[model samples]
Target: MSNQPPLAAADLQKTQQGNQVARTPEQTLVGFMNQPAMKSQLAAALPRHMTADRMIRIVTTEIRKTPALAQCDQSSFIGAVVQCSQLGLEPGGALGHAYLLPFGNGRAKSGQSNVQLIIGYRGMIDLARRSGQIVSLSARVVRAGDEFSFEYGLEENLIHRPGENEDAEITHVYAVARLKDGGTQFEVMTTGQVNKVKAQSKASGNGPWVTHWEEMAKKTVIRRLFKYLPVSIEMQKAVVLDEKAESDIDQDNASVLSAEYSVLDNAPGE
Candidate 1:
């Protein structure tokens, strides 16, 4: 055996102390989170009172619970995670109800498959609330004269409960964003817009558009109305996603290209 020097009592004591200092779970997680790749992955603002370590744990658990998330590309998966964290939305079918749809080959651009990120209506409201862009918002189907119209704003107190509002016969959906700066923006989707959105949804292979037509209409109105509102960075990312989706749809329509997956709804944190 080759010996450089004998260990002194101080060295031995220091070694013992170092060995005794076990890493906490959080600390260990932070070590992994400090990796340059991980730092780059988490480019969005984390939720209140949540650290990068905590977000990693949460997102990892979500990806584990939802196998669909595993099909996403690393970058897209990380983007979804970042969006969820920014929106304070729980993953894996939890509170925020975020879901990822991976489109293989169909919508891919530059040899990259498309991954669509979506959040529930509740998440949309939460994001808007967090941004303080809107004071209050609601949408409902109402009977106005001979036509069925969706009313939204301070005047509309009732939220159309989908199936429950069957008697009202929704012909249009309206979305109103009451600004914190003391003005209101409104968007209305006519039946024609609804049909167009439904056709787009069907063409995109999103789902049976008939079942989700109302939701899609409401979302269209909300998506359009929020475009002019002062939104957060998370919202800006969502807007970019929307614009890209629109471009994809336009390309599909004009050039006979079909997108198997379509980015749906306003982003979770937007």
Candidate 2:
């Protein structure tokens, strides 16, 4: 081997640094979230009740609990988190407000999974209540043995009596929204109708739809009811986002699914 000249101390240090191994995806994600710029972006997107630090902690905790999330497209994952924060909902927590799920992007040659945000039934209810137009809202799955009857007309009426058998098969789902002005709106769907909606969801074969079938069914009815309720714009956006996540449609030719939430245009090391 031959060297034209020995590297200076500063040059040697620079060379060594340049040759260092790159950070793992997990490490890169954590570092990016900790960056001052990313933190500011999160703060700007988050509501007043949540802080950037808390949001970061929750996301990091979720990534640790589900390592697959670390493998997701970093920007898409961050965008989903920002969407949750903007909606005042926590992601991947016991509250079941929202979920961060990974799905294989058909476009990725590397078979990389992209993250999708699923809003839970509870999350939907929370968003609706935030509108302040609703005094109370609730959804339930009716079992085969339950006493249920509902009539929809000028005088809409609904009545249900729970069956003693707690394990009865689910036969129907319904949602009732009580408005602040003493008006009530309700929607009832037979299990067949709910199944039809489920069959159309790209995520029906997995994620919350599989693990939380009853919850998903209830949310389906509530989603139908939302169209008639006086909900906030954020709530409307959440519904659209939820539907998009379930459908997994590609509006643009991006490798990963894009959400409507505002996110940092340039992620770290982009």
Q: TM-score: which candidate is best?
A: 2
lDDT of 2 by residue, 1-270 (tens): 111221122332343355467766676577667767667767877778889899898888888888888887655676677777777888874777888887766433335667778888888876765555567777887898888999988899999999998898999889887776788888999999988888988777887889888888887888888777666656777777877776756312223232322211111221
Instruction: Specify the highest-lDDT model's number.
Output: 2
TM-score of 1: 0.56
Clashes of each: 0, 0
Taking the tens digit of each residue's C-alpha lDDT, what string does model 1 give over 1-270?
111221222332243354456764334333444555455445335555556666666666654554444544444444445555555555444554344445555343334444455544445555565555456665433333344334566775324334443566556677666665677666777777767755554224553133344544565566676666666655554545443443344212222122122112233333
Q: Output the lDDT of residue 32, model 2.
A: 69
When summed lDDT is taken over every stretch of 10 residues in candidate 2, the lowest stretch is: 261-270
Local distance difference test, each candidate: 0.49, 0.72
Candidate 2: list runs displaced more than 4 Å.
1-22, 108-111, 250-270
